[model samples]
Target: MDFHKLKKELITYSKEIGIDKIGFTTANPFDELKSRLIRQQELGYQSGFEDPDIEKRVTPSLLLEEPHSIISIALAYPSKMNERVESKKGMRRGIFSRASWGLDYHHILRDRLKKLEEFILTRVPDVRLKSMVDTGELSDRAVAERAGIGWSGKNCAIITPEFGSYVYLGEMITSIPLEPDSPIEDQCGSCTKCLEACPTGALVQGGQINAQRCISFLTQTKGLIPDEFREKIGNRVYGCDSCQTACPHNKGKNFHFHGEMEPDPEVAKPLLKPILTLSNREFKNKFGDVSGSWRGKKPIQRNAIIALAHFKDETAVPELIDVLVKEASPVSRGTAAWALGKIGGEPAFAALVKAKVVETDSEVRGEIEKALNYYK
Candidate 1:
């Protein structure tokens, strides 16, 4: 079925469905990715999702029975005014990264791809289609690069000239043999802004990211954040975009993908007080639809406590004292003690001392003692 014409029709249909960019290519073998993941595993970069058989599981070729073509697409979700993104003095900006500012990309991108597939089926009835939105075994950046969508930048993100690194990537794996776009050449010369701007040194040489050290992954990972990395996480209560913010390629960019894709102002640097009081139901109602809510309120609450602690805002003392008094979660108690220690003063000391007496968890007790030491 004329592959070139099919690809063109697919791109046209995809745009109508609201996707910003679309390109077709062969499935990447991800040989380089597998080797890099192995090395990262050795270095303890993937501690949270460290599966011995990760290479076997996440490989692109292993996902589909007889995958012949890949259709990669991009969606732009840019931040609104620059004021929302600007760094504040005592309080950090609470903006979601550019990609996550709207409805979850997984659902949005999948819906668009489904429509594209339906259009293809009308043209070729027997076409077999499979798609993924970051859940694929495929190396998304690799597939994106191979499709001429964008080059993988030093921050380990796809960088398109039009959308910069702010575009979300999704793909379709099909049995049909569509003509493929050639891979784009790397545009990052000697610039190391992304690597240099990484607070925890997660980005090493040659676009490698240490997931264990990545603030974005750590905040979402279902485990106690390692103490060494916690301080470096700073005020990023959710995902981080420090490297992307530092990239010259991402600065002063215009997004023309979807007219409705504006960043939500309420989420852009929200007050520290309200976020601290989110009930589980309320948290779910607000964030459950987004991709960041996969871990539910536990991690986000933990991160909020951490960010408040890192900010050392004395204003949070009253709310923290309330949490210390009534909150039952051991993790909450432990983080509260840590925050108290960071906030350090008469009020925080008194709360820590009171919490220490009633706290049963050994870890929480330990944090309480550490906090009380500041008073001494």
Candidate 2:
């Protein structure tokens, strides 16, 4: 079988199927990535979301039997929202990062992968294949970097020269011996913008990130955000894009290549106060389609409370008081207590004093006490 001719045909078909970019790499074990994973694990820099087994993460062969090569695909997303929602005076909105602006990318990428898998199977009748998006064991960034889809940028994003870092990445492992594409050279020369722009100093150095300190990761946590990072989180309700936004390479690189990636002005940048009161069903109806909702409503609600505090939105004080008094999630209740203190007024202070009397949870009580001290 002419594998080279087949690779050309697959590339052509990929373009026809709306895949923005595609590349191939030999499925050798990722040695460098294993070392980085070990170091990240040792230093406790990893977000708890990563696959725990380092061996499984770095070994593609372990994931798919006799994998000969891996195909990486990228779909560019718009960096700038084409339409804007005006936040009137006394009203503030929280921003989900560019990645979460549209429909959940996992579903979109998976659909593209399934199509590619079918296309390959039609050509090579007995082809073995496995595909994965972000949740998979293999590192999507590592695969994209090796497959020449893009270079691993200083912000830990795969930065394609054409699409910049604002691209969704996914991969498929296949048994075919397709010729590997050349990896891009490091293009972040002498640029410390991403490092300097990181609010939590999560970008420890070029191409390395301490995810534990990342605001993007922090916004996804389902517990009370650490006090030190809460103020730094700003109005980000989902992921943080400070590093990506700061990259010079990404300048003027917005692309709206796919219709599904377009952001709904109200959904992508929803009002902060409204988010505080969303019922479970309301939250699902509004944000379930976005990738940011993967951790569910608790994290988004918690972050919305923090964003209100960041804005010191006096109008939201009443709603925050209600959350402190009635919210079931201790994280939400505790964060509301903190937000009330941050936006202190006679009413907000009174509510805190009242919540302090009945709040039984030790952590929530501690937060309430800390908030009360803010008035003093």
Candidate 3:
């Protein structure tokens, strides 16, 4: 089989398999990205992605051992279903963004990439290949841009004109040399909608993101959240899409997807009332296939309580009391106390006062005191 013909065939196959777009490029190590990663480390912007073993693979030089061809694929995940949830009037209405509304992209992208990889191997038996979704060392947006599938917006997301930034990226690193796609020019020009819309100012000037200040990272982080970000976290419990939501490029369009990228109905309008009731076992069963499950129940549960607090729904006070008294995890207990304070009234206030006497953990006690201050 001709290598060029094989590449074109691969593109067709990728589209048929429900990928939004596909393109090819040569493996060129990103020196600038490596330097950026180093800087991010120095400034503590890389808390979530701190595995040295994985960091080595993130560089193009380390990712492509022999350096031949690159195949990048984009899967668009839209908010047609979740847009209704965002349109709701009450504080129960908050955005889960779009990309994370269904099954985890890692699984969806990997299953497709594995099939694509197998097809290529059958065509060229001697060719070598490795696949990486967001988990690998290489940057998905950078590789996607290099392949000409899309341009990186000022928010640092790969933005397709048709689909905007609501896309999941995956790559196949291969030994077979193929034709390369031309890089697109930056289209952002003078746009700062993403930066301006950030609730926590995580987007610094020049398209840089300070991950520590990022609500998405903070919500998923274990242990205590820094006091600075606590109030700004608002109702978000998992990943944030404020920058993407604020981007003019993404507004007023109904970008769609096929197959695994499709949104799950259950997640579209996630019930806050039921979210507070999930056991760890139930959480795994409910969200196991979704991207939000990667951190397990602790983060989501904590965020649920915070979202309840944001709503200031006294109705949730009973549930918060149940969590504060019965939940074993410190995260659940601490956030429950915080929510009780935020929903302060006779019932909630009285419950907090009761939980405070029995709460042994210093962190939970501290939160109880904070809630107590609101009551007094």
Candidate 4:
């Protein structure tokens, strides 16, 4: 089998199918990644979503029988929207990061990977292959970095010269041996822009990130967002893009190759108060297709409340009061109490005072008391 010829054919096919970048690497175990994950666990830096088995995560052979090579693919999404969302009077909108702007990237990358698998099967009828998007056990970044798709940027993203770090990544492990591509040289070069731009210092140092403090991870958590990061979260409704936007390589790197990847302006930057009013069915109808909605309605709604607090939107006080008094979810109620306190006034203060007396949940009551102190 002419593996080199197959690789070239695959590359051409990838482009034809809308893959922005593609690279090849051996299915060798990722030793460095295993150690990094162990250290991350030790330091309590993990976001709790990582697949816990380190061996399975780094070992491709375990995932696929006789895996000989891995192919990494990237698809660029637009960094800037073609049309901007105009915030109307008395309406404060929360921003979803560029990564979560359009359809959920997992689906997009998976579709590309599936097509690649089918193409390979047409050439080698019985060749074994395993494909994975972000949620797969294998680290998409590690595979992409080694495959020469891009360098692992300080922001912990794969930064391609062509598409910058604003690309979704996926990989396929195959039994067919293929020639490897040269790894990209690190070009970050003492640049600390991403580190400096991290709102919660989630980027502990360059490539290392404390996911617990990361606004992206925090926004996806079902529990109450920690006090330290809530104010830092600003108006983000889902995910965080500070590090990516701050990276020098990403400047002038917007790409809108795929229509499915284009974001609806209103959905990407939806009004804060409206978010608080979404029922489970309504939330799913509005946001289910987006990757940020994987964790479902609670986390996004909680983040919306925080965003309202960040804006100090007095207009949100009534809705927030409804959340504080009528909401069943303690996290939402507590966060609403805090938001009301943040947007302080007679109504807000009165609401908090009322909530403080009647709030059943200890956590919610504590939030109310703390919010009342803000009035002092």
Worst 10 residues of 3 by lDDT: 82-91
Q: For residues 127-212, write the lDDT of model 2, one tens digit per residue.
A: 89999999999999999999999899889999999989999999999999999999999898888999999999999999889998
Higher-ranked by TM-score: 1 or 4: 4
**Which one wins on lDDT?**
2
TM-score of each model, paired residue for residue: 0.92, 0.99, 0.92, 0.99
Give the CA lDDT, 0 to 100, for residue 51 in model 3.
49
> What lDDT tens digits, residue by residue, belong to model 4 across residues 254-369?
88899999999888999888999899999999998888889989999999999989988888899999999899999999999999889999999998887788778898888999
RMSD versus native structure for model 4: 0.9
lDDT of 3 by residue, 1-376 (tens): 5888998899888887787789888887766666777877777767566545535645555766686878999887865764344423333633455667777889889988998988888899888898999878778877898888789887878888878888889999898889898977788988888889888888777457888888888877877676667667777767888888888888875655565656666564466657878877898787787787787777777777787777887677788889989988887898888888888888888888888889899988998899899866
Cα deviation at 241, candidate 1, in Å, is: 0.6
Separately for all candidates shown, the number of backbone clashes (residues 3 or more apart, or on different chains) is 1, 0, 1, 0
Residue-level lDDT for 140 in candidate 4: 95
Q: Candidate 1 on 1-376: residue-level lDDT in tens?
A: 6888877888777777898889888754767777877777788767454445766434556777777888899887664543444445545435345555656778888888888888888998987788887766566677788889999999999999887888888888888888888878899999998998988888877578878788888888765677787778777767888988888998876665564455455564455556768988888787766666777877777777777877777777888888777877777778878888888888888888878888888988987887787766
Instruction: For candidate 1, give the lDDT.
Output: 0.76
Off by over 4 Å in 3: 50-55, 82-95
lDDT minimum window of 10 residues, candidate 2: 82-91
- List CA RMSD, all candidates: 2.5, 0.8, 2.4, 0.9
